[model samples]
Target: MAFENPSREKIKELLQQSDTVAVVGLSDNPLRTSHSVSQAMQQKGYRIIPVNPNATEILGEKSYPSLRDIPEPIDIVNVFRRSEFTPAIAEEAVAVKAKALWFQLGVYNEEAAAIAARAGLQVIMDRCIKVEDSILIPSGKTKK
Candidate 1:
């Protein structure tokens, strides 16, 4: 079956309920899209956990080399890596019990989506989380 992203309403709901976002492939460079988007989310009250092997930190949050390395519960696994890299990330997200698996704009992989979906994770692909948040929750998410 062809994969479909969740409805905008569902996306909005997820954004509203989720608090901690683990950004995989998040870059240490401020100019990178991952860094900028994560920074924006952090400003909007989401806790952004940076997951990058090469960096010690990004956006002032300590970076983990992989999803399994993060010690806290993750509400969302927002991926900035390429499509080819996502299936492994999906597996890791499942292992870590992430609430959602989000593939950033231009990143899509059927295998990854299926893996996450089978694990009961809300899966979103080929869309920008930052853009979605800005449109769906322009006022920003409320603190729980």
Candidate 2:
């Protein structure tokens, strides 16, 4: 079966409940989409954990090479990598027991989505977390 994202209400609930977002493939370059989107998420009060082997730090937060490298529990694993790499990231997210797995806009992988879902994690694909937050979060208020 093809993968489908959860309902809007469910997405909103996931956003509301999640606080820490581990951004895979996040770039140190400010102009990159991954950097911009993660910055926006940080502005919305979500702690952005940059997961990129190349970066030491981004947006003032320590960067982990991969999900397994993060010491703390992750609420969401938001991936900015290409679709081809998503399945592996999904597996790592499951290994780390992430609450949800989110693929950024323009990135979609049904296999990865299925894996995450089977692991009992909320799955979001081809959507921008910052955009979703702005739209579904009541009154555009930043999460605390």
Candidate 3:
């Protein structure tokens, strides 16, 4: 079956409730989409955790080599890697008990989404978290 993104309302709820996002494949370069998007989200009050093996720091936060390396609780696992690489990340996200698994635009995997969903995690694919935040969350209040 094809992968579908969660509803806008659900997205808004996730964004509003999520405080910390672990950005996988985040880059140190400002030109990268992950860097810019993560920065924008950080400005909006969501803590951004950079998960990049090659970078020690990004957007003023300490970067970990992988998702499992992060010691703090992660509300969202936002992935910037290609679709082919997301399943492993999804597995790790499930193992880490992330609340949601988000695949950036152009990165979509049905199997990964299924794995996370079965594990009780909300799944978002082929979407940009920053864009969704602006559209779905206007008041910054999460629905209870």
Off by over 4 Å in 2: 138-144
lDDT by residue for model 3 (1-144), tens: 676777888988788889999999999999989999999888878889999999999999999999999999999999999999988999999999999999999998888998899999999998999999987765553434
Worst 10 residues of 2 by lDDT: 135-144
Q: Model 2, range 15-71, lDDT digits (tens) per residue?
A: 888889999999999999999999988887889999999888999999988999999
Worst 10 residues of 1 by lDDT: 135-144
lDDT of each: 0.96, 0.92, 0.91
Q: Estimate each model's TM-score.
A: 0.99, 0.95, 0.94
> What lDDT is reached at residue 23 by model 3?
97
Candidate 1 C-alpha lDDT tens digits along 100-120: 999999999999999999999
The candidate that wins on lDDT is 1
Clashing pairs in 2: none
Clash count in backbone of candidate 2: 0
- What candidate 3 gets wrong by more than 4 Å, as runs, is 139-144
Error of 2 at 82 (Å): 0.5
Deviation of model 2 at 30, angstroms: 0.5
